[model samples]
Target chain A: MTGTGRETTRGAARERGSARWEARDGARRVTEGSPGGIVLEIAGLCVDYGDGPDAVHAVVDVDLAVHRGEVIGVAGESGSGKSTLAYAATRLLRPPGIITGGDAWFYPEAGEASSRLNLLDASAETLREIRWAELAIVFQSAMHALNPVLSVEVQLTDTLAAHRPEMSAAARRERAGELLEMVGINPDRLSSFPHELSGGMRQRVMIAMALALEPQVVIMDEPTTALDVVTQREILEQVIELRDRYGFSVIFITHDLSLLLELADTIAIMYAGRLVEVGPAKRLFRSPRHPYTLGLLSSFPPLHGEVRALSGIPGSPPDLRRVPSGCPFHPRCRFSLPRCGEERPQLVAVSADGERRVACLLHDGRQSPPAELGNPDAGSVPVAPMAAWGPDGPDRSLPPLDDTALSRPEEGVTPHA
Target chain B: MSYLGRRVGFYLVTIWAAITINFLIPRLMPGNPVQLLIARLQGQGTLSTRAIHALSVAFGLETHQSLVAQYWHYWVQLFHGNLGLSVTYYPSTVVNVIATALPWTLALVGISTVIAFVIGTGIGILAAWRRGSWLEAALPISTFFTAIPYFWLGLVAVAVFGVVLGWFPLSGGLGQGMAVAFNGTFISSALYHAALPAVTIVVTSMAGWMIGMRNMMVTTLGEDYVLVAQAKGLSERRVMMTYAARNAILPSIASFALSLSFVVSGAILVEIVFSYPGIGYVLFQAVQNEDYPLMEAIFLIITLAVLVANFVADLAYVFLDPRTRQEA
Candidate 1:
């Protein structure tokens, strides 16, 4: 209500006008006994850097629901605001990234009896209790995530000391050891400093510290991005195993759709500041609904099959500040019709079960190219051949496949060359 | 423990090298103070060749002795705490004169630096964190304090606090005829005399610390670990102090150690301007009269202070930054 009307409450808008197409994301009522035990619900969330029209629209009105014990992988190119979403949802986004509107409801307990707590409006004291205890985060960089001066023991016990004050000093320390052991690290290394460990070891240590408080939900923003392929796989296995044991939902954010394919149950592809496609990982991989998703998928040839030269998307991801007028991806969309340029597309169910949703005019059977526009088949123009759409996942540095087939899913990869 | 042992060994070698160099510098200078001492004592009158030889012997600088023998004797005398006679002060030994002035300089410079560092670093953290806020607008204006030299700032301080305000005495280490004792009045008098120079030093160096710390803190704020700390739900105060300030203060500590060593040499121009009789003022007198013993003794003390400061800073780094402990 305070801001100039640059933001819209889509969650409220949906309630007033129950448009048929708006059912794409399913019913987002956030009630206690919803389908899956949705741990976190983000609705009508709008985050802009700076103020007014010129401000960088980092995260436009968006709605996302995360279910308990499910791995939800969020994929996007670097500036697509995936990390911003993570930070803002946790109320950690610093200056410039203003959360203009909407709400993020965190269900504190797992069962149907748990009440919803609006994450965006929580007070300092409540946020402190919710942060590490209920929602832990394994950060992007091992080098910068752990305090370089403090020992691993101190960093792990700091959360315990802050929140679990009833535990004795010896009990707290023993718990720190148990946490480290659960992450497959030697408990004796607790006294070692961050710099004393290798990159892989440091990342493991970071994971250990994150699990220290047994948080209900863990947001891993490229946690394994700084390690090698072997180490990355190992760390992923560790995280998955821990999630299975604790039954905590994970929001894993990465740019490599291929990596997420192996790890996540569901994958959500983001373009500009909005999600173009969101679906179950296997189904989306088999049949992508959005042209952007197709382009990203084509960038990685399927292993154990005839290898087609990867065709890269013709243009770059849009800048959030100006975000193209209609469908954010219309400018670079291969199957874009004239209607794509004239009207914005909402996320609508494309599949029979309402499980998979896409925001492209081509799927809705409404695309009608205007005759005035040159080259009616401009949408059919071929993308770049030998498309080296190298994902911006911090860990990805793969060489071009010569003859070997590499199975990789990419969420939002722009051509590297 | 091995790392600590290595550092101790390193400091010992460095200290030895510094002592040897300090011994050579004054000896290498053009004039021999023995001749000047003889001239002053004998009133420029011609003397017999034997009398000249006797005078040299009496002053413990016999020209007939071998260079190596004299060097050996110098080391032996040094261990016994004999710094030789001061040509400028004539009767007073170099050790006694330095001892008198050393405490005053240590008290003034040490206290000023500690106060300045604390104030400056605190302000630096505040300024960088708030950045564009009105609360810290005055920090930029204070940077001019660092740009002004100590001597100039000292004179202005004297003009203001000593002359204009008439709150403190104008000059000389303490009141000209004040008693030198451990009594409360004597201590207060010394501190009062030291006030102006202390203020000048604090103002000049405090600004430097703030600017340096502010830049480092700004860079530190962007580091991934800081973001991690925030996401971990640490209180803002805890995050700023444990993560940001703890790291930002590393480089500041090194510079602080360097500044601490300079305290012994005392702020030469400031001391002269204030007419305060610290080691720096004594140094000024030594150089003016070419007093080799006094000059060499003071130089040795300064060199040792610098070496020890560097060694201490190395130890501090090991304690404050875990990255440096990797080599161990």
Candidate 2:
């Protein structure tokens, strides 16, 4: 992906300053690879379910970044904590799901660190201001996520009223109708309560409400998990279409690897609450670096290819309370080594250009990546381009990570005033 | 059929059944109201057979008519609102006796119930929203009050606040010989006498509402919509009031409507303890004196009150919750 490189970073950030979705469609190509492209950055994020020794460390020392106008899909198993990471980063985690440590910096100016808001350290008022107006989230079950007593128009207009105080009631109603239309629903159904709508329509209403304020980042947590295939695909298309048209970043989280492989620009594979691999979607699908990612890829039935016996990874997800020491995945790893059980491997660069990284001992350079994982350079399944926006090409603007950015707290991320 | 129409039909059938049962129970029992009246009057003079017959007809205890014919007459009288005469208050009709007591009961129990529900439900919402607040800490104390029999509490209140402290009147709906008019003196004296009983009912019953509402609120707080509302960055008050409590209060409303219906019956024990001259106190006197006509009238009124209240509750559910508005 050709990002808006360094020279135009300041210019691009200025041009996109608080512009509504209607005003800017031409300047939507400012996706991240360079420092100017990153919209959200998390460093050393750790989340726990409870306090003291009995606590289940749901998300541990994880680092991720979502570039402007990028779709970053997070794929993990049931207990992988992808949803927890999203909730913690957004400061939406309920009690007993505490952010023990983390630095989640939301950069409205792309990569300008000075303007970034520290999500975890912000006061409740600041967090409320940042939420919905800047960052919106689409929850898993729309039926339960919507107020049953309220009509669709009321819910949509409520969000608008809370943040868009300058908007008159008439303007808010008109915008809500427009949002429903944008999400492929008839505007006449605006007065219908949630129970009055079908499941797919309710989900579409949820999407419309989330996008009502034209937020910069929309975090979708398994939004289509309960939907049928056709409805899921339709919602997914609308989501991508909305993201493209608005130039906002999306954090799409799900357990379906095949879905993420088809949707995301960059896919992050998590296991046992830790990221096991991070790479371009096509490259990761064709040439998985981590054994867990390989296991996940093999488990999904290939849409086009010679039929093969689908071998699911041996053992269920680890009990978070009793997660095995060292590499948490070693107990179920197909390519486990004695050393794998003794020491945990950190996610590090696997490609020469630092475009892909994996947390596996085989990819640590002491030994070659196992033949079972397939050669990265060799031709594998010829998958289609990531999404309608096309593949994220060589992302060379990403700087090589050192120990500081990986495990250390970010500098200059003080709490918002 | 439409929801309102269906509910009204159902309640009509229920009322018919209740009135039929009320008619049947009195006839099924031996020794009619006229016989009991005659037995008491025998002390004044030996009544002639013709005088006995006239008394029986006046009390609607005509034995010459068949039961079916008597039932028909009962319905006819009920339609005209003729509830017969009270044996206990010999000169007054059943309707007159109830009319005198209804206002007192309605004012005392209805006001006390409404006060309890409002204060209790408000405390419940606050306690659940701020789970560990001082109000929540005080919940157990309220529960203790609820566990204590309200009549016992009323008696204790009478002993302490009425007898010892002399802060309020000890009993009755109004001061003795206070001319029960709409004048300021009568109104103020009536309120003064009602103070102790109202407090007893409010303090004891408010806890049940609070506990019920608190439990519902806790469950509702975990609903996905509540979390979504919070995530929408709305103020805490908006989330609590509109999303959480709005949904949580539904079940409480149903029960509240039921209690509102029972307000017509009054708190029997509390009224007896205070000798509060409400329907409950009158009903107690009727039963003690075996005033069958008065008892039957009061029972029918209480049953009809329940049916009407539930119908009103159904109408409210349609407004408050869209889910219930759909066709079954």
Candidate 3:
């Protein structure tokens, strides 16, 4: 991959600014790997479900950056807080799902300085102004998301009327028509009610409405989860195609790792509300450093390889209220080290270029004896090319630690946010 | 069938069923309309058997015919715009008696119901939008008012504002000394006497509408689409009114239509309580006097009123709810 690094990054940089599905003005161009490439940066983000002791710590301390025009997928099982992370970042979390800590900065591209608003710190008025105009969201369950009583045209025009109140009705209607067409829907269906359309059509309408304003960032939470495989693929293709045309970034969240692996530019695996690993899609799939990530990989059946008996990760997801101390995944970790139960791991670089990071004690050089072993590259995953790695590439048969040694929190990451 | 065709057919069948039931109720009574009329005539002079037979034929009482044949004749009479003569008011036709009282009921009940639906629904939207305020605070008290009988409210109004306060007349539709003409004095006096009963019906029915609307609004606020509307960056007022309340109002519109017909019967009780000379009071008199034809006419009119009102409501839904307009 290093041989074509320059070409790939340039391609990705162009991908960020091409989401111009609708005719829009004043859209600034962004180059990849530049300061302006980061569309949204969330730091020290912590979200709690309730107050005090009984509160469910949904999204614990985490930091993530979504580059302009990149499809960043968040994968996790139910209650893993992948959805919560998206909601918190967008400041869409309702009462009881409070953003206890976080500063999500919206970095407007060059020449669009006024839109650089902090999603969490903005006033209600500012948030309203910035919501659909600059940052829109495509919610899950389109059947429920689209207003049943409203016609598709009305739902589409509602956003335009709010953000562009000065536009003439004819122009608004024309724009809505174009949007439906952009999402592979017939413009004539604008007058149709939600119940009149199939589930896939409803989902497309939602996407059309979200793209109505040409927002810079769209956070889609399982937008295609309710759809069948063919419909899901069609919608996914439309999303990516629209993103490329309009240059808007996407925060695509779903538990379907295989889908993310195929669709996302970068995939982040969250476990028990904590991010366990983050890397480029293919890189992470071929080489998942975290035990939880490995378990998640094993759970999904490989489509293009020899069929293997699916081994779903043992045990249910931990209760958020009674989340275990230290590493949240220690109870479920198959290759658990005694130190994994006593200390939490912060995201640390594993690969030389620091393109990949993992939060597992095995990767912590400060606590691992493998670093001092005979082999110079002990405990580090071999940087094998994609073609060389099989679907189940990780060495999962390794023995559990018998050292029973405990260590302090490495990288100064506390047990809880 | 097409959607409109289906709906029209359904309504036609429903009307037939209602009219059949109305016809059956009068025929199934123990004594015939002719017998009641003969008893009234007995005081004047003992009638001979031949004279009684003529009276029975005059009242359209075909006693010797089978029930099915009588039912057929009743329909035939209805088609010719002939409702049998009143047993109580012997010379007057049922149509004439109802027509006389119908205007008074329409004036009193129609105006009062419109006022209640408007005020109640408006207050309900406001209360649900601003839930912790004084209007919402009064929900329980308002519910309590609606829970009481319609006449009880009328009686209470008469006691507090009529007999005790001396602000209005205690009973009757208008002043006894006022001449019955199309003059300003007669109209104003009639309105003055009706004020208490109208207030009673308005106060009670309005509370029910307001409570029902408030509950629906709360449920609508929880719908996912409402959240989506908010996410659209629309103003709070737009979200509340166009999105939340528009959908919330569907059930209310239907129920409001049904309630419009109910105002007539509700007026009956209020009219009796205050002796307001509307169709309600006239119907009460007919019932007390066993005026079979008059009683039958009033019930038929009420049923027609209910069916027509509901039919109109169903039509209104086709306009408001896009889901129902599908051809299927």
Higher TM-score: candidate 1 or 2? 2
Positional deviation of residue A235's Cα in model 1 after best superposition, in angstroms: 1.6
Cα lDDT tens digits for candidate 1, A305-344: 6878889788888877677888888899777777678777
Q: Model 3 residue A78 lDDT?
A: 95
Worst 10 residues of 1 chain A by lDDT: A399-408
Candidate maximizing TM-score? 2
Over 4 Å off in model 1, which ranges?
A1-35, A110-114, A303-309, A367-417, B1-6, B42-55
Q: Interface RMSD computed for candidate 1 is what?
A: 1.1
- Compute each candidate's TM-score over C-alphas: 0.85, 0.92, 0.85
Give the lowest summed-lDDT range of ten residues in model 2 chain A: A384-393
Lowest-lDDT window of 10 residues in candidate 3 chain A? A398-407
Worst 10 residues of 2 chain B by lDDT: B171-180
Query: Which of 1 and 2 is the better model by DockQ?
Result: 2
Error of 2 at A48 (Å): 0.9
Residue A16 in candidate 1, Cα distance off native in Å: 35
The residue-by-residue lDDT of candidate 1 on B64-139, one tens digit each, is 7887787788888889999888989978999999998998788888888889999999989988888888636767
Calculate DockQ per candidate and list them: 0.61, 0.69, 0.52
Q: Is the docking of candidate 3 incorrect, acceptable, medium or high quality?
A: medium
